[model samples]
Target: MPNWLLPENIADVLPSEARKIEDLRRLILDNFRLHGYELVMPPMLEYLESLLAGAGQDTEGMTFKLVDQLSGRTLGVRADMTTQVARIDAHLLNRASLTRLCYAGSVLRTLPQGLHATREPFQIGAEIYGHAGLEADAEIQHLALTSLALAGITQVRLDLCHVGILRAIIAEDATAQKDEMALVKLLEAKDTPGLQVMSADYAPITREALLALPNLYGDITVLDRARQVLPALPAIASALDQLQALAEAAGPECVTIDLADLRGYHYESGAIFGAYVPGLPNALVRGGRYDHVGEAFGRSRPATGFSMDLRELARLMPGAQRKLAIRAPWSTEAGLKEKLQECIVALRKAGEIVIQNLPGHENDQDEFNCDRAVVLENGHWVIKNLD
Candidate 1:
């Protein structure tokens, strides 16, 4: 293999794509700040236990683990940033009131999430801690939608799900609770036959509820159907009510429900959601409430957040145009050089992109589009339009 070859599903981002990604990152983070979210930069790697504090098997499987040389403890490359931010809130800050935190960084996964997905993703997101009410969930959902809009992804479909629904159903039957993981997989796949065979020994009501889940997906009206078809367990009712409130808050036009979609079933404590747009088979963003995550860090607080791969989201956006620049010639004459440098500095200070053309690279074509040039006309630097 060639020395320049990169690992599979990992490749370098060249100038154009990198520019788009960086610009989008700044835009989203700035919006987050405006919404009162403080930025936090967590390390890319940490002790395995701390990294997977309240995460489930999925996160564990995704995390890349290695033994630490100094502490001799196992360390993990973070596959997700939510848990790290949660730990910060629980131990580092320990604030009592509502705390909003946002982060943007690279995360490594042991395996690629999809056929064309990257093993290393530029993850960007925001989290709200200490607020357990449905209002916080609504705020997060709205924030996510607004962020997508800022990225020019306007035709979005917000599919909402609640982990509590399945938890409530499984709580009614010991057999189903024992086979929770298997049942969750079946539900996610919408495998009615598999669920039927596995849930045969479950209580009749549990089996019926489990079977009913696969069909309980569609617009907000699905909630009404779920209320009618599923058993009226108090927990189930509460989960449905919360889902309804959040869906209404998100607006009925683009909101939908999926009772069987249990993507974050193990990690999320309450409502979960995913935002999808055209041209992408997978969701562009995923988030929900994980109130129990902080408990593992010794400070349990209500928390909810959402994250998206900035690289992937950037691909969906229109390519960034080459920035207009002021091209200046390099000069070595004492007086002329100083004056030319001053002019270039002044232009740059005024937010203009200034590119100094090297002696030999007079006709070099590069990233910046230089439509204007700084020339030493009659002993003074002046700007002139390039022919």
Candidate 2:
């Protein structure tokens, strides 16, 4: 095997792609700051129990675990940043008032999420804590859409779902509650026959509701259909109402509903959403309310947030153009040397990229496009257009 060969689904990002990713990261982080979201940086690895505190089985499966040589405790490489941010809100910051936090960092997953996905994803997201109302969920949803819009992905489909719907359906039914994980799997796959077989021993209403869920997906009208088809339990009704409100808030044109989607069913408490863009088949961003996550840190707070892989998002954008730069010749001539150094410093200070070419590298081609040149013309250093 070649020594330079990277692991499967893991590859180095060269100059152009790295530039795009960095630009998008700055743009999105700036937008988050403008929205009053304070940035937080959590360690890439932490004690396994702490890392997986409120994260569900799915995150556990994705996380990479190892034993720490110093502390001798099991440590985990974060597969997601949401739980870490939640822990910060619950323990470290411990603010009594509403707190908004955002983070951007690389996470290592045990496996790639998709065939072509990278195991090392640069994740960026924002979370709102201390508010349990639908308003917090709405704010997070809008911020996610805005972030994508800032990235030039204007045409987006925001697919919304509520974990509460399924929670409500199985609340009283012991059979359905016991088979929750299996039911979620079936629902996510939209496996009607599978769901039918799984729910055979469930209560008639529970069985019917479980079967009805697979078909309850589409535009906002799906909510109306959901109201009629699903039971009239308060929790179910409340979930539908919240979904409707968020759908209306996001505007009907760009919104869709998928009661059976259940992407974050295990950890998400309510109003889960996935933002889909034109080129990507899967969601470009995923977020929702996870009000119970903070409890794992011994302080329960209402929280909602969304995250997207900056690496993946950058891939969808056009390649960044080579930045224009000024090429300067390296000089050691007694009088010209001092003046030339001053000229380079001044140009750089004024926000110009000045690349000093060594004598032997006069024909070198590099990342920056040197469209201009610094020359000692007529005994004074000045800028001139490169021929």
Candidate 3:
């Protein structure tokens, strides 16, 4: 293999791992369906103008741009599913006043240093468009919780923040946006001194908020501290109230708020949230509201969506254990192979994994790796239990 031929961050998923990932995605999509969110497979490639219309800064840098041969127009591979859903909401489903859309597909983008460095990631997510209140936010949070529950994750931690709060504060100080972006990265890294450096030149109110950012973690009480520091903004206050209600709805055990969390695209204008399993360094799921994206696309609809990185969630799953092969030792005769295939189909229908016996390659070691064995001996069906 030539050294420069391979892409920098793409990795192949082998059969065993791919099977588990498919199963995981199925579980998540089923839960989405159960909640009345219909599945949608937006086109993997869309016109470059349409695709980039609503995507914020975080996604812009990652999009893989190209030109279409047939149409002779600029085109791009979707870097994320959220913007495509927004396009559908604004145009394809333009007649529908309210929509709930779900999707599962691979998004191509440059991976950050710590994100397992996989540029191609499988994303499963939902979007709720045309609603613009706390109820919408609550519903999004509920979807996140129930999806995790269906995945057999009993201990999920939520880190919630309001982009409105950060944006509101930053608007007062022009320097704050540049500073806060750097400060957010430092805070996410848990570096207090770095945060101080970022906020050093800001006014007292802004600097104090940045200094206090690290301590804005913990339970609902942290909201009280937020109120004390930046009390006047109604948008921030209403967002805080919304979080309180959402926490009550999510229950104390499954959710918690970390005001310091600043993940997601930069255009978020309302609440932003992330989901984490205990040991993972990054969030498995992320989302927020970006009302401006609609206007950016020449549509007036406000939208909010969340997407779970199926790759990261697949890793954190407790039962990511690989399934052993199931082998059959039936004779290679036409009649016997047909009967064996019938049995294998039945087992598969019952949600069991089965491996067909390879002709002319059967050995004792191959037979032992299977869950069970069925063999034809003396015209009788002989069953052997490997386990």
Candidate 4:
């Protein structure tokens, strides 16, 4: 086969890996449902204009663009599920008040030519549209905690920050522009000195806040420290209050509030955050409010949501050795398929790994390389050990 025929950065999900991912997806969705986020499966493909309506230039760069032959117009694969949900809220939902939505699906994006990136990612997320208050932010934060717990992730540290503070400061003062991006990079790298150089232009108070960010990652006490150092900027103050409330709601042991987690997508308008697990370099989940994005689609409504990088979470999941396999023999041909299916179903019910095979193939033994086998003997079920 020609090399050019290969799809770039995309991958095939094999049965084992796919099953693991599907199980993880179910866990997240179940937790989300318990939190009152009704699932909404958005289209895999949408009109390019509609999908790009609320997405920024950075997001646009990742989209897989193409023309729809049937309609003679351009279309694109969704790079992110949040934007698609925002589109749904604007045109399809059409509700007067808040609507809560959750979704799980595969999203496609283009990777840089040489850099390694997953072009196809599985995302599970929730969106809340129309509410405008810190409570909404707090509620979402709490839900994020619940999601982590449901996924069997107990050692999770939530880094909470407010985009409004950084955006407000940047919009009012251009002097800190370069420094802010630098600070973002510093945090991304976990580099402290780089942050110091970048934040040198800011006021002593602002500079301290920026510098304190990388090390400010911890429990509820971090919020108290931030309150003492930073001035009472309303947006920042409100975000802190909400964070404290969420910490309280999630209990002292399960959640933490970091005042310096200021990195997020350009569309964010309020609180932003991500969930980190032990041993994972990247966040498993990311979310924030982007009220302004709705305005681009003529909705002019406030919106907030989050998405989990299933790939990242999957990477963190404790490596599971494949389940012990069971092989069924279908030699008699007396309703063999049905009998084999029954055995398969029974094994599944008993939580055992199972496979079914034909007569001679039993000796060939490729299906699951089964740990054990069940053969039909004479007129009765006989067992054979594949050890």
Tell me how many clashing residue pairs each candidate has.
0, 0, 0, 0
Worst 10-residue lDDT window for candidate 3 reads: 362-371
Q: Which of the two, 1 or 4, has more lDDT?
A: 1
lDDT of 2 by residue, 132-194 (tens): 898999999999999988889999999999999999999999978889998999999999999
Q: How many residue-pair clashes does candidate 3 contain?
A: 0
Error of 3 at 44 (Å): 2.0
Candidate 2 displacement at residue 173 in angstroms: 1.2
lDDT leaderboard ranking = 2, 1, 3, 4
**Which scores greater on lDDT, model 3 or model 4?**
3
Q: Model 3, residue 108: what's the lDDT?
A: 88
Q: Write the per-residue lDDT of candidate 1 for residues 93-192, one digit (tens) a residue.
A: 9999999999999999879887599999999999999988888999999999999989988999999999998988989688888899999999999999
Q: What is the C-alpha RMSD of each candidate to the true structure, in Å?
A: 1.2, 1.2, 3.8, 4.4
- Summarize candidate 4's per-residue lDDT along 205-274 as a digit string, tens digits: 6666666666666777888877776666877787677677766765767566655555564677777777
Where does candidate 2 stray beyond 4 Å?
A: 363-366
**Where does candidate 4 clash, by residue pair?**
none
C-alpha positional error of residue 222 in candidate 3 after TM-score superposition, expressed in Å = 0.7
True-structure lDDT of candidate 2? 0.91
Find the 10 residues in a row with the least total lDDT in model 4: 360-369
Name the runs in model 3 displaced over 4 angstroms.
Answer: 2-6, 113-115, 170-211, 318-355, 363-371, 377-387
- Model 2 worst lDDT window (10 residues): 359-368
